[model samples]
Target: MSLSVARRTVTTPILLGLLLVAFALLALVVGSKPFNQTIIDIFLKVIFVVGLWVFIGNSGVISFGHTAFACLGGYIAAWTTIKPMLKGTAMPGLPDWLMGMEIPFWASAVLAAGWAALWALIFGAVLMRLSGIAASIATFAMLAMVNSIYSNWESVTAATSSVVGIPIVRSIWPYLIAALIAVFAAWAYGISRHGLALRAARDEPTAAAASGIDIPRARLIAFVISGAIMGMGGALYAHSIGIVTPDTFYLGLAFITLSMLVVGGMGSLSGAVLGVLILSSLIQILRWLEAGIEIGTTTFALPGGVQEIALGAVMILILMFRPAGIMGNRDLSLPRGAASDSQGQTGPKT
Candidate 1:
């Protein structure tokens, strides 16, 4: 790579990492417990949305099922981290070996990534064969199937009831580290040969195939990587709230994360991070309004459900005016005048 190209590669992740660090510091400075928790939530959303961007953005396929991987990861946290006695009472169906095992929160997150990736590979082997809407529908079916199984498998999953006793991680540092890991991982994949191939296939499938690209293989690689990222996110999410439930990682999460990606510009990594930050800030403000913000002498408050409506309206507005997202297809980079190669190229499009 040229000098400018190498610099750009390193620059994107650094800038994104700094943004996350800034948010963490802001939360610390505020020193409010609720605000700190909100920052942690934002970091988790960054992980989830960025994971989705890795596959959906590069492959040009919308997946309604990535949250299923999160669901898997969340339950893995419950199985591995809860105390043995608690596990026995809540999930009597767990095998003796599993019920007796308990690991730290971080270890569970690692295992969750692997477990989710294993399932992603299995499912992707069959689902990756199809493309476009067929692939999208198949993924949604995967989500529904996973949800149904988790919701009714009383022996292992505790059915629809919440699984408690997860180790709550209130510290913002671990979340910050995980979010940085996710952001760097996504950036590395984007600039890698496989990611380039996948994007090529996405933009011109016929041409890519004609040039001997294994389109399905490219997509499957993205699927597995994205799955692992989402899995880790889910595990951290469980720790953040100290609870796990089938419904927590169901359609609601899927839609919100997907919406963040879509609103940020599905094709841009910067968009994924920005989408989470912007929407999360809006959500927090709405929550404050709902709780009755004091304006001078009077208390002003929006209705309870206005947050959801506002989110929907903001998404609609973004789609109508900036369909490519705030960042469009371009990444956050140094100014065009800052650096250039002999051919006047700065770096790859992403």
Candidate 2:
């Protein structure tokens, strides 16, 4: 690659990483435990949304099942981090070796990624065969199936009950590091040959297939990579709160992450990061309002559920005005616009 092209290649991730670092510094300056936690939440959302972007942005496939991978990862954290005696009491059906295994939070996160990736490969092998709405439906079905199994497998999963005693990681640095890793990973994959082929298959399916690109194979690669990222995010999420439950990684998380992707621009990696940051900030503001702010003598507060309502309204407004999302398929690049390294485009058609 030419020097300018190489410069462009690294610029996007560097910009995104700097943004995350800025947030971490802001949280440190604020020093409020609540604000720090909110920043951590934003980092986790960044990880999840970016993970979604790796596959959906490149392949143009909307997946409702990615959170199921998160669910798997969350349980992995619960199984591996909790004390052995606690695991035996809460999940008697765990294999003896698994029940006895106790690892650190970081180790559990690594294991979670591998576990989630394995399932992604298994599901993607079949699901990637379908396209359009058929594939979307298949993914949703996969989510539902996973949810059902986890909800009922009482011995292994504790069924619908919450599993507690996870090692809570209150530090912001870990989350910041994980989010940066996620950003770089997505940026790297977007420029890879597989990513290029997947986008080709997405934009010109018949032509790409005619040229000998295996669309399913390319998509499956993205699926597994994305699944691994989501898994690690899920594991970190559990550590963030010191608990895990089947419902925690279900539809709510799936929708919120997807909304971030859509609102930021589905085709741009920069959009994914911006979506989470923007919406998460708005949510925090609404939450503060709900908790009531004291202004001189009187206290003002919005309704309890205004955050959710506001989020829905904001999404509607963005969709109406900026149908392509806030970024609109553009990466956040340096001033020189001639060399744009957007994940949405793989340079001019040769």
Q: How badly does each model clash, as a count of residue pairs?
A: 0, 0
lDDT of each: 0.90, 0.93
On residues 1-350, what C-alpha lDDT tens digit does candidate 2 reach at each position? Answer: 34555566688899989999999999999999999999999999999999999989999999998999999999999999999989989999999999999999999999999999999999999999999999988999999999999999999999999899899999999999999999999988888778889999999999999999999999999999999999999999999999888899999999999999999999889999999999999988888899999999999999788898899999999999999999987888888847566767745755
Error of 2 at 83 (Å): 0.4
Q: Which ten residues in a row have the lowest lDDT in candidate 2?
A: 1-10
Error of 1 at 177 (Å): 0.4
Best by lDDT: 2
TM-score of 2: 0.97
Task: TM-score each candidate.
Answer: 0.95, 0.97
Please list all clashing residue pairs in model 1, or write none if there are none: none
Q: Model 2 segments beyond 4 Å from truth? A: 1-6, 337-339
Off by over 4 Å in 1: 1-6, 336-350
**RMSD (CA, angstroms), candidate 2:** 1.4
| lDDT tens readout by residue for model 1, 71-133 | 999999999999999999999999999999999899999999999999999999999999999
CA error at residue 64 for candidate 2, angstroms: 0.7
